[model samples]
Target: MYAQCPDCLTVFSMDAETLAQARGHVVCGHCETEFDALASLSSQLPPEPFQQLPEHKSSGRPPQVESAVYRPRQESALAADSGTTPAAESEDFSHLVFSPRFARPAHQNRMRRWPWVLACLVLLLLLCAQLAWAKRDALVVDPTAGTLLRQACNSLGCRLPLVQDVQHLRLLARDVQAHPSVPGALLISATVRNDADFDQPWPVVVVTLSDVDGKHVAMRRLRPSEYLGDGFALQRGLPSGTSTALVLEVEDPGNKAVAFEFSFE
Candidate 1:
């Protein structure tokens, strides 16, 4: 078998029968180069059992060639004979014969994408939860509820137009009579201004009533016309000599109601 020196690129031949014996240290005839012939022919050679050669005694005659150095041209010629180029021969590659040590696992490849999918799912759920929470108090009114709301608004002192429908309403009532000389009644009203603005129809109103003794006397709903035009009318059936303070409140589907407050006397 023929081998090429990697460092000096010298070519040499070894006896086929003695190839295994001619391994590690061998003398090259052409360039008179010494090389690790076994390593140089690794691709074209197979492994052999470790064996030590008997030491050679020096010859009496002076050496014909003083230095045996391999050359690049000789290396190329040897590579061509071996059906390979010198560049191809010296490449540090073991992949042709052995697999890589660290190959990626199939599960690891799939797991790399999971975090993004999980995040998207979590974001979608959060969006749905937020939407539900935002609409939690959305009111769905029927004709009956609309009528009741209208009637309640009319019973208070606030004056408002006839309400068509109510979509949402929030009412807050409080009693504060500490400011005595002020009117004993508190009124609130709301209404829709135009048909184009009917999408959000319901309006909320708050009313507070208080008396000179820091007490609330009477509270009731008033009609839009009554509230806007004048103070709400007192309901009948009170004792003739008794005095009662009143507060009025009203909410109109349309924002056309007027809110006001005054003492019944």
Candidate 2:
């Protein structure tokens, strides 16, 4: 019987012994491609296998070409020899097409991309949260951003520093005079007012004592605790649109200290 290699379409003789030994799987002798020989087994050749030359033939019959495979496009050239019909000409010959059996899998499953994108977004959000927490003190200066941060902090059970707006705070009044009981000392006092609608922390008072020539004589930076004691107002923050008194006593810079200036931070 005859068998055709499904890969290279090489036609060759097959026996029961060889078919049983390989389980109908045979390697093509012409192209060395391995395929199931039983898939395209046939009793005879083409419709014709290949072109037949008459000059090399001594007999009326065609030469026996062992490695030749059928090609229907060349069948009409040998029609007088095989006498094949039009019905046989339309038969399926798809098995004779060559295809690589060892390439890629036909049904491979791929990993989706959205999971990776979601992970990246989560990491980015975490980074932004960290940055916001680190700069919360600076962010509280903005009215809108501070409101959002305060609301978030309330829900998250976290506390943020009070809003400090130097522009909203100013000295309502100031006084500098000799200390009552202390010798060679001067007493400094100022009334600072908060103009904003919201309550804020007490500002650091920067006192600059200048000489008669308007040159700086002495400087002092006093925190709320230094001038106001450890009172509830220091922690609860100063009320809005109100004024607070500040008193401090310092050693006088001799008689050249004739002028003094006050600033708040």
RMSD of each: 22.8, 18.3
Q: Which ten residues in a row have the lowest lDDT in candidate 2?
A: 49-58
Candidate 2 C-alpha lDDT tens digits along 1-265: 5776655656687765677779988888888898777666655555564532111214678668888665456566566568864346466754443433332245421235567878999999999989987887677766788778778877999767777788889788999999999999889988888887456888888889998899998998888888877688789888778888889987888888889999887
Residue 207 of model 2 has an lDDT of 89
On lDDT, the leading prediction is: 2
For 1-265, candidate 1 gives per-residue lDDT tens digits of 4466654565555443445455457766666777666554532333444233222345788668868554335777887799976764564432333223234457876788799999999999999868744543331123454445446656985422322333222222334222334343223322223221112322222242445554554444444334433323222222212232333333222222222232221
How far out, in Å, is residue 236 in model 2? 4.6
- Could you give me the TM-score of model 1 versus the true structure? 0.20
